[model samples]
Target: MTTYPPNIAKLFEPRPRLKYLEHIDIAPKERSTPAVSGLSGYLAQLKSYDSEIQYTPTEGPIQKQQRERRERQRVQQAKVASDLARWNPSEDPQIQGDPFKTLFVGRLDYEVTELELQKKFAGFGPIERVRIVRDQRGKSRGYAFLIFNSEYDCRNAYKESNGMKINERELVTDIERGRTIKHWQPRRLGGGLGGRHYTKTRVWGGRTNTFGGPSGPRSVHQTRTAPRFGTRPAYSLRLGPTERRPYERQASNERPERDPRYGGKYGVYEKYKDVKTEAPYKYESRDSRDFRDRDARVPERREREPARDKKEDRTTRFDRSMY
Candidate 1:
């Protein structure tokens, strides 16, 4: 290589623009994030996955476990993606009945069949259809959709049936998100309200969640809904017990059931009516056997006490030690 002349070297040299007048600051290009595509959204979920996967002919215990975990995560994530893809809120064939009358049931036990769910929830309101979401292999995905005949019934079930335990799994109820809620996505799409995957680091929502939310069914039910499952009857404190409006149900019966029990919301349903309980007017069963208690060779009213004079007779301060 040879040095060029001054004029030629000057031509080869790049000219610099004045920074004050024309130069503009260019931002550094941002690092592009990995795109998730197809039926595999689990790529976003892998916190401990390796960037460079290396396979060994001979396997150690840790390596084998890691491999298995990775595979399991992949499969589970793929299933989630597939579910998201299959269910379209706008134009999906699987979704039947009115959107307003459909209730989304989540956190279901896979073993809980549709019949069992219907049986347990029937007390709430009459159901039109019960659909348990299943994968391509026909295995349960642990969620369901219940279609009620009326919107009132659907809302009642959503409010009252939420957190009800069936098959040892507490249920989570929601309105039909795809149609009812605008721009809502399922948990698989990463846009549901609550989740069961609350760890020590992140508690989104659960029974024992650290955020101190409602612990179980009782708390949620009492806070939100009336005691009974169906439509609440109109009543006033000024009115008598039998003066309240009848419960106009969309359930099986055409005639509304008139509840006459006198009290609060719990005054409606008599859960223990079938139970053979002792009469409220009558005292304890032990009252009938008072004679047996009197013959127990023990004094009653209170614990056996020393004679009043003996109690009054106190030893002197000097003689107290001797007593």
Candidate 2:
């Protein structure tokens, strides 16, 4: 018979029934006292049940994976934000002095919107956002602003998008200026009292008062018309076939005499004759009939004195003869 340690036998006997059979058999076999029973399996089952029944909570694999994913996303977002803040255009030699990170897209179709701008510029790099300018009526103003995630992307998009065509129109893309621009307004060509108030003025005899003096409101009676002869300069008359002397413009100290050749000696009568003529007052010429009226004013009154003698004496001659 052989004997084994209690601890060694405990290792070989796992079941209670197996331990009992080992104790009953004694035929030239290695035998020993069974130090332990099959309580380890029961203990494992109890441990599992205890864990299930306990109040303390535990996360599953799926929940643990989801938490890890959310943490990673948060960290990535924070890193992106910090990078944007720390990015210095002055430090980058490639950026030069122009630190603009926005692209000014012009000549865009009137129908193009914010989403179209994003779709077109996104291929260049990561875009921060897109903004399309609109008017007071909520219509697209045919331009947009594209902001990128980095300076390189901004420059790249600017270079590549220049002269690019969309909706059959070539686009003009450039680096955005740092200043704010006023919204575009159509130039007002016609408005107020100055535009529609223009009258079609006709200048007569090739003469206009355009450069003469300060313009005053013209009355219907103030217009002075030129003579039918011509309006050539007085110097030009010297060059004509008539070869006249240079007209000497002298100042007169005495009042000019009214000749019978024109109208009459009376100023009022002369003006009345001028007003009855077709010519303007400033250019009225002498009339042949005016000379005939000059003699008729005086001798015609002496001839009218005989008319009174004829009427009174005709009746008196008969009465005197009877006396």
TM-scores for every predicted model: 0.39, 0.26
- Compute the lDDT of residue 154 as modeled in candidate 2: 92
Poorest 10 consecutive residues of model 1 by lDDT? 233-242
lDDT of all predictions: 0.68, 0.59
Predicted structure with the largest lDDT when compared to the true one:
1
lDDT by residue for model 1 (79-165), tens: 888877777777878889999999988888889889998898788789999999999999999899999888998889989988899
Q: What RMSD does each model have against the real structure?
A: 29.2, 44.3
Cα lDDT of model 2 by residue, 187-294, tens digit: 121111111122434343344323323456643223322333344232221122323444344446554665556645665476677455343222144321123223
- Tell how far residue 132 is off in model 2, in angstroms: 0.5
